[model samples]
Target: MKRSAMVLLGLVVVALGLAAKQLPGVDGGPAAPIAGPQVAVGAPNRGSESVGVELGPLVIEGRGTRTTSVVGDGGTVVLAAGYGVRTSGAAPALRLSLERRVGSGKWESTSAPVRQDEHGLHVSTPPWSASGAAPATTIAYRIASASFIDAAGVAPAVRSRSVSVVYENQAAYTGLAAQIYRDAAPYCPTTAVRIADLMGDVAGDYQPGTSLIRIDAVVGTGAMARPEIVRSVALHECSHERQWLNYDGTNEGRKRMLAAAAAQFSSYDPMGVGATGPSGPLKSDIRPIEHAADCGAMALEPRGYLGYGGSCSPTQLEAARRLLTGGRY
Candidate 1:
């Protein structure tokens, strides 16, 4: 066949493959495929002849009464997906499938299959629920496979893709924000903490919930470096988070939590320290939290290999020690 004829033949094969089946919910016109947000997605390495697959914007919407008991009150939980597919002329028709609550003791299909169309593939399948099911906490959805014929032979290239369960009347992200607020509220001298990634001559405030944590996004002679380092810093701050959440929700409570944290720093895994705790140089303070937060940081080995300097200030350690030991010393 001539080059032009070969190209045309390839196109014809792909068109036929795409038109082979209509998914249960697809409209069957040119698809307006959804674009996935820029995110760091972790998928297992599955070597296949398949090219990259453009995932659609997946949204989970739900509506139901808020209560300690009872699942959705016939409330609607919709799973919508939109994506596009391109294939080799000789490949088989791409098949799309859905699976829910994966890895659980039992596997089940929550919704029927929908064919991919020119408009790409979309689904707004609502799960059936009675008014008396247990309160809905989460729903997990996945694409079982997108099979196509490739040079390697008949195979389902993409293993699976999933979206975390979304609660009703709430976005998946809003819940996370709310959780940050709730966890840090009491520790927060003010409403919320500020987070930033910038340059400063001096070390910035390292308050638990109040101070914004800085994450270095750039790379150069001077930068915060990688995400792991930033995350380790955040974990240090989260010690403050635990301080607030477990306390009595009062100033005295905050002090108590801090003091208790100081005491337990040695008991629990200190920063920088490995599973056995800090093994390096020690700080001046006898309190453990200081040891863990500062000196422990030096010991605990973070994934990013960002080295720890020292433990927290001795003043706070003494204050906590005074409280824990009832000021006897």
Candidate 2:
């Protein structure tokens, strides 16, 4: 076959949605706290906690949460607190800090942002990710309020309540993941990105209800082992998230989406989903949703390799353009 013909065949291969070969692939607290904000750890990794601080005559109380184990990069820890007068009738100087222990390592200190107000205050810590740090990763957060900081910014600090959670493959990859997610802003800005080893041929996937797009690590020809794998899979999964964003509102729309999603889940095995490579099952099988996702990924940037294929079929591209360019699929 000629080069052009082979290219067409490749698109056909991707239409099967078994597109090309394998792919690639948080903290603490703070102070005399007065009614801190309430933040659950969140679904799929949610945890709950309620802590109280004694301010003498007035009790400073709040609730915080943490997940036991985090799977990927870009996960975050939220710490919040509010300001009030201590027993000494002085304004409490609060500092929120996070202590991170990586793979049975020493606790590293990290400063966190504090949301404050009379009613209540809460703020999320900087995004945390694991890369080389593993085996046993934990983040413990503490809320502390200095007895008082005079003009010199010195005072006796008394730490209050805290919570901790473990993480996997934390750090280094965070910057890369952030770049991928930032580039994906055109497709889905609100969606999250995670980096971890998916433990199979699977390089990437989108999880429902969590608004998370996962890009696997270099596991058995997965995420980072290959060039363009992370970008390809990340954007590809983001496409799925972009598609679902439209369906999240209505019951009928959700049914349409779920039905399509179910087909995607049942059709391809992780070990055998290569559009042009050996994993493709057939040329006739049409994986429209996956193709749409591929097309959607391409819409983000034309340069990166797509997991399904480097390029998309005209039909799939057109469909994706319709959805991403403001039309419903």
Q: Estimate TM-scores for all models.
A: 0.29, 0.40
Model 2's number of clashes is 24
- Cα deviation at 1, candidate 1, in Å, is 97
For each candidate in the order shown, give its overall lDDT on alpha carbons.
0.35, 0.46
- Write model 2 residue lDDT over 1-329, tens digit each, in one string: 89988886665434324334443210001111233333221111123311222321211121212223232344453444333332222344455444445445665566665555554444444555544435334566455544544432344554545455444442333565665666565655545557666554455665432345566544113224233544556667766665555664222344576465434432332232223453544444535566567666665556545555433545545556666655555
| Alpha-carbon runs more than 4 Å astray in model 1 | 1-57, 61-71, 82-86, 102-106, 130-133, 157-160, 166-329
Candidate 2 lDDT for residue 254:
44
lDDT for residue 304 in candidate 2, whole number 0-100: 48
Could you tell me the TM-score of candidate 2?
0.40
**Poorest stretch of ten by lDDT in candidate 1:** 62-71
